[model samples]
Target chain A: MKSVMIVGVGGQGTLLASRVLGRVMLDAGYDVKVSEVHGMSQRGGSVVTYVRWGDKVESPVINEGEADVLLAFEQLEAARFLPYLKKDGVVVTNTQQIDPMPVITGAAVYPEKLIEKLEEKGVRLTALDALSLAKEAGSQKAVNVVLIGAMASSLDIPEALWIEAIEKTVPPKFLEMNKRAFELGFHA
Target chain B: MKELLQGNEAVARGLYEAGVTVVSSYPGTPSTEITEAAAMYDEIYCEWAPNEKVAAEVAAGAAIGGARSFCGMKHVGLNVAADPVFTMSYIGVNGGMVIGVADDPGMHSSQNEQDSRNYAIAAKLLMLEPSDSAECRDMTKLAFELSEQFDTPVMLRLSTRIAHSRSIVDTVDRVDVPLRPYVKNAAKNVMLPAFARPKHEMVEARTVKEREWAEICALNFVEDNGSATGVIVAGSVYKYAKEALGDTVNYLKLGVVNPLPVEKIRNFANGLDKVYVIEELDDILETHCRKIGVEVIGKDLFPRCGEFSQKLIAEKMGVARDESVSIEESIPVRPPVMCCGCPHRGLFYALKREGVYVSGDIGCYTLGASAPLGAMDACICMGASISALHGYNKARGAEAEKKAVAVIGDSTFMHSGVTSLIDIAYNRSNSTVIILDNSITGMTGHQQNPTTGLTIKGDPTSAVDLEALCRAIGIQDVQVVDPYDLKATRAALKAALTAECPSVIISRRPCALLKTVKHKPALTVDTDKCIGCKACMGIGCPAISMKDGKAVIDATQCVGCGVCTDLCPKKAIG
Candidate 1:
């Protein structure tokens, strides 16, 4: 069985990214279960989704230290959910910063040197500026697709399957841009 | 075809396949998507009623008219509809009636962590709890059959985990069951003393027959692994137990949680040396087993609150995993907040400045109780704010009326708030009420309400006028102000507090996140004129932050609501 944890702020298309992954896994004949956050928690709050796929999956949630891959949409969120990663797990993170409410309200400061701090934890990291890549591809919202592209390398699934899933999951109007974004992150 | 579906979506599909002709529901977390998904089917007539009670009544009326009908609500929403739910059990249904109530055991987005199973038992209703998305579909289809067979309303209980989680569900074709012809039978339908007494006896007799059916029902079965230790579980917890214990332990998984199969449970327990009941929240099964003189382990080892995970079950059962690690550093909490351009932000900010003790209601405005804005004093449930403020002022007399106000949302006012407003006027209480009219239901993903002039499928309809409604309800003072206009909102609030009669101030604005609402260009902070006063920060807008002792607005995050500009004493924010 393999477990992937997707972590990001609410309304960041993290759920869409997980949905695309779930479709790819399901199409590949794996039993997939995806658990997501909904309602109030989706209002600019920390959102975490658990996607597990295998011959037969049972629990919908991934426990601490059980995730094979951690897909982070933001730098701070990457560090926040680092504990869920297995010792030898791969981290596919986007180097983007969205300050928490406390930081915005001046009650707390945004953490510094997040990547260095995560490196000290000993997990293999593939960090990139997915926002820039997505912008170059024509839309900033495609950052999730870009991160999904980076995450595709960590799994045994083929790049073509990921692209096919992306095409099916995203709307046709922005299909070309998202495809460009995914390819850029795949080779970044 | 097989598709990945959330439990709610599967239930909706099940309703569609069951040939349900009528469906009604109120928007609530974990259960909202059922009706939303049902609205997609052209064959079914789906609508969002004003409140859960109305939803239940609509479905009940439809069933009485010879149509297979369904209604859904969250845990607390069931409470609002409980009056009819309890009596509907005795009256029964002419056509199949299925009620979907999703319980939040963890209180994830609810005010309380309530067990909906207690309602099933108290009302003497038949209840089925599905473990996953597949069961959510199959059991829903089965629930309708059971409802028609027993002539009772079937409760399909769902929890947060089961409702939101996604799994593969095999597709099924629609089965067109002919609706039973409606006949006016006073002995069964009417609840007068003479008729209700006999109906109550019939309900009890039905329970006995249902218990017998449950003992041999296909929904309740044993998986004999020939293990000495056995675990009896239901709902989503069964999946966790199977994942944790694997095939090492025998299992008795129950799909029909209420009127629990007593004989089946005893037979399964007798076959094992030891038995355990695994359930989330209150241990209804454990209590039932003990009453039947069967020894079982439950609740004593497991927690009575919050949802359970596979790891928790494994640890409690002393089962070891392949890998387990603990981290020392505690992660900082990321609490949900109002959106960047939220209309409620400015209203709460103005209320705080006015020094009014706000009694809030459910919806996005409940975030007003959070820090920085800290305007709301209490929030109990849907539409409780108006009644709570009325009683609060009645206790403290006229002095308290100046300090207290009730804050409710547009959808909520239509739900149950209108009655409370009438109560205030009839009782002659000098309480002030602020209706945060955000154009649509802000929470639960912007579903259309009566005030929005749109139906479940976005068809234009008659919009409820808030000012006219309040005036018609004997409220002499009815005023409207834009929440974005901070000065006007504050002035209206202050005037309403001192008004001799009950008054309602409508703080009207469209939700910032609404697709139909257009946002202005993002605001910019002038660094040259900026002095670090931290006044704009008090509004708690996520887009506004302080950088190098001066306020800075993130253009990417800001929607240019410009409510923050009113708070800046220096006028640095534009």
Candidate 2:
């Protein structure tokens, strides 16, 4: 079984990213289970979604130190959830910083050098300014696609399959922008 | 065709395939999507009732009128709908009726962590719990069939894990089911003491027969893995045990949780070296095992409060996870808060400034109790704010009345707060209630309600007039104020607090996240005029933060509500 973890702040389109991942895995004729948090937690809170695929998936959750790939949509979330990644796991992170409530309230300061810190931990890391790439792709909301593109490159999945999954998952109006965003991160 | 479906979505699909014609539900987290998904099917008639009680009664009425019907709500909502459910137990359904109740063990989106299984046993309703989305679909169809076959209403229990999780589900065509003709039998349909006496006898007889069914039902089965030790479990907890223990332990998975089989469980435990019963929240299963004269281990190793994870189960059961290495640094936490330009922000800010004891209700407004705002004193449940506020003031007299207020959302005010407000008026206890009318249900992902002037299907409907309703119920000092206008909101709140009679101030503004509501360009801060003083942080808006001793607003999140603009002493934010 391969376990993938998607971590980000709420309202960052992580749900859409998980849906695309679910689509790709299902198309490969693998049993898949995707778990998500909804309602109150989605209101500007730190949120995590799990996507697991195998011959027969048992649990929908990915426990601590069990994830094969950790996809972070923001820098702070990546550092906070690093423990979920395995010793030999791959990290695909967007170097975008959105200060959580404690930071904004001056109760705590936001940490610095997160990507560098993760890289220093001796893990295979793919880091990028996904927000800027997504903006260049015509919509900042496409950051999820950008990170998915970076994570896709690490896995043995084909680019055509990812594109096909994106095409099937995203709405018609945002498909063009997401495709460009995916390409930018794929080659980054 | 095989498609991925959330458990809630699969239940909706099952409702469609079961030939259900009536569906009524009130929106509650983890359970709202079931009715929302069911409404898409034209063959089914769906509506959002005002409360879970109304929804249950509507479903029961439909069932009694000879149509398959269903209603879904959260666990606490089951308490509100329990009156009908218990009675529906005595008055057996003419057509099948199913109730879907989602329990939040960790209180993810709920105010309390309540288990809904006890409600099934108390109501004498047969309940089936599914572990995955595929079973969510399968058991739902089976629930409708069992409701008919057993001549009783069936309850389908779900939790946050199962309801929100998506898994592979094979779709099937709708099966043709002929509706049973309604027969006028006063003794069975009416539940007065005279008619209910005979029905009471029927319920006892039905339980004995159902126990026989539980013994050999396919939904409750054993998987022999040739292991000495075994685990007995149900619902989503089964998945955790399966992943943690694997084939090292034998399994007895029960889909029908209520009225657990006695002989089957005893047989499964006879040869096992150790028998462990794994359940979340309560020890209902463990208690049942002891009653059936079966020795099992549960609740001793498991905490009775919250959820269970695969890691926790593995640790307790003497299993080991991979010895993995990763980062161990701690970071700041991100809590749910009022969104940027949230309509509730200004009202909560003004209330916080007044230093009043604000009784809060559930919704996005409940976030008022958190963070820098920290305005609300107590928040119990959906409509507790108004009623609890009245009791609070009555207990403390005029001293507390002048220093307290109840803040509720528009949808919540419609749900059950109306009667609470009336209690204050009739009893002549002075109380101030502020209805945060954001024109829609801001929580549970924006479901349409009576106050929204729309139906579940987005059709126009008769909207409830809050002002007129208050006046008709003898509230003289009724006022409306836009929460965006801070000065006016404060004035209205002040006037109501000092008023002699029970007063109501409607804080009217549409939710910023509403699609029809457009946001202006993000406000910019002039650094030259900006002072180091942090006056704008009091609202706790997620968009505003300090950068180099200056207030900075993220343009992406800022909706330009300008509530912070009024707080700036230096005229820095505009």
Best by TM-score: 2
List where candidate 2 sits over 4 angstroms from the true fold. Answer: B326-328
Per-residue accuracy of model 2 over B1-574 as CA lDDT, tens digit each: 9999999999999999999999999999989899999999999999999899999999999999999999999999999999999999999898899999999988888888878889988888889999999999999999998988988999999999999999999999997677789889898898999999999899888888888999999999999999999899999999999999999999999999887789999999998899999999988888999998888899998888887889889999988788655555668999988888899999999999999999999999999999898999999988999999999998899989999999999889888999898898999979999999999887899889898889999999999999999999889999999899999999998999998889999999999889999999899889899886889988898888899988888887788999999999999999
Cα error of candidate 1 at position B152, Å:
0.4
Model 1 CA lDDT for position B367:
89
lDDT of 1 by residue, A50-72 (tens): 99999999999888778999999
> TM-score of candidate 2's chain B against its reference?
0.99
Top-DockQ structure, candidate number: 2
Which CAPRI category fits model 1?
medium
DockQ metric, candidate 2: 0.77
Error of 1 at B357 (Å): 0.4
Worst 10 residues of 2 chain A by lDDT: A108-117
